[model samples]
Target: MTAGQVSNNGPKPLQRNLSRRVSFNEATLARSQEPPKPPAEPEFIDTEAQVVSRPPYSACCNSCCAWTSLVLAVLLLLSILVGGVYFAFLQSNLPQVRLHRLDVYYLEVNNTDTDTFLTSDLEVRLNFTNDNSKIKLSYSRMTASLTAEGVDLGTVTVPAITQEPSSSADVRARTWMRKTSAEEAVAEDLRDNSLKHLMVIDVVLKGHIDFLVNGNKMNGFPIKVSCRSIDQSEIDNGHAPKCGVQMTPL
Candidate 1:
């Protein structure tokens, strides 16, 4: 080989090396030109948790409601029992009162031009019966009003009385009225009835009564006895008519 000329084999090796270096540089430049990749994000996992909670006063409220219901039920039961006992006692232990006889002694009516005057004398008898086995009854003063043919004659007062169980009592009342003003028509009717001996009188008695259970005084109740159309002839003929009795709450 000449000194000035390069050998072909040596040059060929150099060329090969330069080509490899050039290919590696091209690959690095291509990687640089591409866009940069973002950082990897952390993986996320979804999880569900179950929790149990209760109100602060739930147990206390439940207990209070239970006690309240129990108390109300007990009170209701007691009231029912007491009411039933009271009703039963009242039904079985009430006293009975009746009007036995009514006697009219003198009845006179005088009439003027436009006015009328009446004079009368009457007697009333009442019979009171207590059928209770263990109760006693006491009565207040009784007032009796007499009416003849729709004319108010007079009113009489009877004394108070007391009756034991299974016992009876009789009361008598007398009334004398003189020169009482009356309606003309009513006075005429009374005069005619009195002359024919067919006069009828209505007697209404009002009073109050109290019951004693084992010597304990109970509440007082009002009593009313009504004797309607009491015939004077029937009383004179030894016949007694029964009257209606009513007992009411005070």
Candidate 2:
């Protein structure tokens, strides 16, 4: 009941409430040190965007196809044109050959009952004509043979010659046989009169020719002339028989 006793009156109700509030504030400050939370999600947009591009086809492909078609058409047209030209002009005007004359210098036979021999010298003349008006003709490496009724008497070789367009030329070859088996057989036929005095002879000519067409020269085509069953009497009368000619390709 004195001053000391009043002073000792332990904590009123207000102090007690103030002490509880101070303790709660210290606890809230301790929890504030944790990591911060992430931000909230934003709203979504609803619009879409589109871009325009060029077409896939181009002019180069079309141009290449056009050129290819044009080239093929031109080649086909040229082939048809060349074929027509050859058939109309070049195929019909082939060269011709003739057998002009054959001259025998001497023919002698030596016969003993056991052995027979013969000797002769001869000359042959030929006429060649080129009927082509646009092409020039030439013959090379010429060779010839003389035969009588399947028996080959002799062979001759001649030099090369050139003939102008639409012109004729003459050539000659000389053959001589001395003491040969072929000559002996020919002599036996003459003695036996097996030819019936017709004196039939054959002339064969073989060679290659060159033809110049449109300023271009092409060679190595074969030329063959064959004259058969020619009479000696015709030669003496200054006349000749026609011969056949062929162009054989090699």
Top candidate (TM-score): 1
> lDDT of model 1 at residue 3?
52
Give the per-residue lDDT digits (tens) of candidate 1, residues 1-250: 7754666456888899999999999999999999999979976644332223334467889999999999999999999999889866775566665666766678788888877888888788878888887988888968888887788878888899999999999988788989888887787788788777688888888888788888689856777778898887887687777777667542
lDDT of 2: 0.76
**Deviation in Å, model 2, residue 192 alpha carbon:** 8.5
Best-matching candidate per lDDT: 1
* Candidate 1 residue spans exceeding 4 A from truth: 1-81, 84-88
Residue pairs clashing in model 2 are none
lDDT of every predicted structure (CA atoms): 0.80, 0.76
Candidate 2 lDDT over 1-250, as tens digits, reads: 8988777775577799999999998888877866677877886654342222434456997898899999999999999999778645544555777777777775567876677776667788889889888899889988988876665568999889999999999989888878655445658775343324456778888898888988998777787888888887686677878888776652
- TM-scores of all models? 0.64, 0.60
Off by over 4 Å in 2: 1-91, 182-186, 191-197
